[model samples]
Target: MVLPTLDKPVGQCLTNLRRPGGLGKDPERAQRRAEQLAAVDPDWNPGALGWTVDWQRHYTGLTLLLEGGAGLEEIVPGVTHRGDDIGRWLARQRRDWARLNTEQQHRLGEMGVKPVARPQKTATRTNTKTGATKGSDAFTRGVAALQQYIAREGTTVVSRSHVERLPDGTEHRTGVWAANQRARRDKLDAAQLSMLAALGLEWAA
Candidate 1:
């Protein structure tokens, strides 16, 4: 598909390859475009046709026509242009075609192209205490230990009430509770604190 020129250069369009409205976003269109790209015959000739912008335009249009099943002889000159210049140029392109630049060639190759191979990211668990990558077992054990400790000593109290007015003019109330986990650690004796320190935890506050 011939995309319209945007605020940025055409080359930058490739940066948004899989984003919304990009060529690869629609699976069906992407597949069809890939088929068209792969169908391009590498043996086609580029004769004396030099690299002019108008010539390039006609050349691109001709290639698109060829992809759509127009044979060499079926591609007439006058059909591509309102003026005689493009018609004459197109007539010569039947045999005397100009070679496309690298950018155009690259664009042709990107049509429905498969994703290139790359290294995949591996999932890992981080050890919060050691700040290093470790097995999930260790992480899970740490979390469970912390949770058990918190449940054993954490003290909770109703801190406030949340009230809201209903459409029927009735008031709905919900209690908000606060827990003091640190106070539990602060209440530990020196011997308990020493035990926790030996276990490599900050449970003694």
Candidate 2:
């Protein structure tokens, strides 16, 4: 029998299978169906593995890349497989290691995944000569505007025509700024990409 693809409907079906009611309220058939799925892939039930299906899917992709002769270094951000960004997922797993449970940590550790050092926060400084803040480059100012917008709106979905006003009497066309950054994303350094990702930009991730 062919296994069903784990799309939304199938995913919901799997979730329902784990409930007390079982599939279609038929204990015997549900048991047989569950057994068949288990025979195909033991970790079919994500709850049993103590993680979400999305997490398991990304982990499987990472393992597949390794099995296909890709090294850890080659798994840096932008590596995509089966439409999932394995590199970004791996980076997030390492950067947020403390958020994972011991089981998840052990699984990742077995695959040579380790935590990354937290980036140091730079203190904002004022220019003595101009009386304005230093490091207010275009990118930096755009990121600051995006950060402020997120803090106020609780989302990164800025309208293309939205303008953000800063507390320092500066106004930023944040929506346009973000669009420009994404358009020339290839020129952005890793640090710039990380800042955009931190602001919840999906493309940067």
Candidate 3:
């Protein structure tokens, strides 16, 4: 801090400032002691005292950012050191959670009653072990046989269930029976069918 000057008040002031015990001065012994202390911090000059405190403040801020107090927020419950409520935070949490082992996620789901992925239900058709294929009823076969017989015999016989609404109206036969029935209800009188079977044919449904 001292500057050379002419022999005057300025000269005296400069001499005082340049003395070894001046405010910015260090003697040989003090310099050696400071060097010993600051050798452990090779990047710094121990003579610059302000650098130490400024460096400490910077380190504290960095630590705070990593210890959940500054910068961003981490919305992932207990998983991160940051505290950012970004738009994708929840989605990120879900992805991270899913990255855990299967058993771990399973345990979490069990704890929270979360629904696990399930196999999708499929459209299934039963494989019948026996009997006719679909759209073919026992009664249908019987009616077909009856129709063939009537066509051969050239005669009309009444079905007990059908005795009204004569379609032929030639004082002819009457019925609500359809000529082209694709579906049939398979019902037969068991006792009557048994009697018919005892005499001859089997009437089955």
Candidate 4:
């Protein structure tokens, strides 16, 4: 906890942004929960601020991911400068809105953009060019896994779970993976079991 300052009243409660107690849970997880609820709620509007590709004349726009915030965000799809957002994503791409021809539409679609509407349950989170994401099979099968672990345990310097150890006593994850999820999963599974048999990947070893 940070120390109380002189300007702040003594004994008054202060909201800690770091811990998320007063700020509420992280928006990503909260959004996932809200969608899960909507799936079960009969009264929920099918158009109830769920994820959609907002076409504001198309040419100079970006995809918006409307999720949890002060209000519904999924209405936008991907975040773009012209659209409304609670705040910009921590990570972002730089685009030149001026470079785009707002009035015209491409017949064969641009490099990183898709024309079809996105669906919820299997909404693909990817990098259009590389098809990559935070935990893409190539990046880390372990991002959400690690984040979920963090949400439960809070802050700590050391961590456990799914850490792979190679020879030479170096403990770390090392490998590339197939582009397909099914193939990637099978590879990871086999690798992990083999590592276990070889006396690596053991939590206590």
Best by TM-score: 2
Please give the range of 10 consecutive residues that has the lowest summed lDDT in model 1: 42-51
In model 3, the runs with Cα more than 4 Å from the true position are 1-26, 42-55, 60-205
Highest lDDT: give the candidate number. 2
What's the residue-level lDDT of 64 in candidate 4? 31
lDDT of 2 by residue, 85-145 (tens): 8998888878767656698899989988899988786755545534433433777889878
Better of 1 and 3 by lDDT: 1
lDDT of 3 by residue, 1-205 (tens): 3333544574345333323453244577666655664575542331132112222223333344445444323323333223222212222223345323455345435434233354676755566523433434433444444433332222234353543322233221222332222122144344323322221122221
The local lDDT score (0 to 100) that residue 153 gets in candidate 1 is: 23
Off by over 4 Å in 2: 1-20, 24-36, 119-205
Better of 3 and 4 by lDDT: 3
lDDT tens readout by residue for model 1, 3-30 = 5656655434432432244457678997
**Candidate 2: minimum summed lDDT over ten consecutive residues — where?**
127-136
Clashing pairs in 4: 63-78, 64-77, 64-78, 64-79, 65-77, 65-78, 66-73, 66-74
Q: Which one wins by lDDT: 1 or 4?
A: 1
- Per-residue lDDT of candidate 4, residues 105-188 (tens digit): 241134233333434555554455355342245334332233232332232122333353433454443221211322344444
lDDT of 4: 0.30
- Candidate 4 has its poorest 10 consecutive residues by lDDT at 90-99
Could you report the Cα RMSD, in angstroms, for every candidate shown? 28.3, 10.6, 43.9, 17.8
Candidate 1: clashing pairs of residues:
47-97
- TM-score each candidate: 0.22, 0.50, 0.17, 0.19
